[model samples]
Target: MLPPDLPPLPALTRAEAELIDCYLEVVDLLGRINPARTEHTYGGLRAAQALVGRAAALRDALAVMHRRGESEVHAPTLARALRVLDGERRAGRLALPPSPGG
Candidate 1:
């Protein structure tokens, strides 16, 4: 459960919500597949396999928004939603860890 002190999620249209959900799903999968972070290839392979569908879903979500004339992304609002959803930490997994000796 999210902490009570976290800000409320911004209101979003159905397509927008779907887009964000799909985007995060892809992010999570990529994080799992990060070679710098993963200890085994099998798990990363599974996540990599799953990433294809998630990427398609993310594409479809954007297409839906485009068809609905929501051409512009409201970055500030979406950033707030991402912050509330722990996107920073999730995305951080994509980065390589600091060098052990440096």
Candidate 2:
């Protein structure tokens, strides 16, 4: 059996969409580079390197939005979009694991 279809993404301005995509990319790279979760230095190093570019893109996206006068963030709408995009799970990789037994 096939899985259910995902809900449609909320309507967003082009700049807002770009911002969300760039933000998620950076978050995913950071998650991969998280020291507590990474299994190998080389893998984390690669992620960190990629993070430099992703972070730049994220910055650029914000700059574009700001220059376009999108000064106010619609947090509720963006949060809904993030939830639709599995951002919570992707970001969870950044958290430290629970210490042994407590």
Candidate 3:
């Protein structure tokens, strides 16, 4: 059962949902990769490990945000989506993309 004090999760935007879906797909594919089917390269293994760690961090951050009532559920015209992304980035749960001018 959900904790009694926890707030309901914010509804996902289409973009947010799509991002999560794509991220999960990569995570799942890496998880199901057969060692026998892929070349035994340390680089691939390292990347997979990094992705697993990042995915865990992202999941945990999302849960904490939900429980703390720190979500975009009612902000129809504000920064719920940006807030989630920025909060996660600031907390080291996710990385911000490089700037176009950088």
Candidate 4:
């Protein structure tokens, strides 16, 4: 189980933990049976991939914000905002506003 305060991974958010557990179960089963025999049939794998992207973005943002002196009081919320901002920047869909006193 994950810590209670932090936001859950999207795969663990929109779906029950049991669903992810089931996916992991299948993945484990395939790993044990014939690792090369199975392939992802649908978006569960895609969603898993996206979730990894999101978590990576969030982690990078948290590191950046921490370096920029965003205190812990604001870190968690700012982490989420910065993750979204970074996503938009990557997608060429948005620009970040100038920092104060910049």
Best by lDDT: 1
Which of the predicted structures, 1 or 4, would earn the higher lDDT when compared with the native? 1
- Estimate TM-scores for all models: 0.93, 0.95, 0.33, 0.32
Give the winner by lDDT: 2 or 3: 2
Query: How many clashes show up per model?
Result: 0, 0, 0, 0
Tens digits of per-residue lDDT, candidate 4, 1-96, equal 974564434422212233333334334333333323334544445544555545554455555546656444333543454343343233222233
RMSD of 3: 13.4
**lDDT value for model 3:** 0.51
Which stretches of model 4 miss by more than 4 angstroms?
A: 1-41, 75-102
Stronger candidate by TM-score (1 vs 4): 1
Q: Per-residue lDDT of 7-91 in model 3, one digit per residue for the tens? A: 3435765544544544554444454343543566775677576777667665765666576665754344223444443433433
- Candidate 1: C-alpha lDDT: 0.94
What ranking emerges by lDDT with the best candidate at the front? 1, 2, 3, 4
Worst 10 residues of 2 by lDDT: 30-39
lDDT of 1 by residue, 1-102 (tens): 965798889999999899889989999999999989999999999999999999999999999999999999999999988888999999899899999999
What is the lDDT, from 0 to 100, of the residue 6 in candidate 4? 46
* Higher-lDDT candidate of 2 and 4: 2
List candidate 2 segments past 4 Å from native: none
Give the per-residue lDDT digits (tens) of candidate 2, residues 55-76. Answer: 8888998899999999999999
> In model 1, where do residues sit more than 4 Å from their true spots?
1-3
Q: What is the lDDT of residue 32 in candidate 1?
A: 98
Prediction 2 global C-alpha lDDT: 0.92
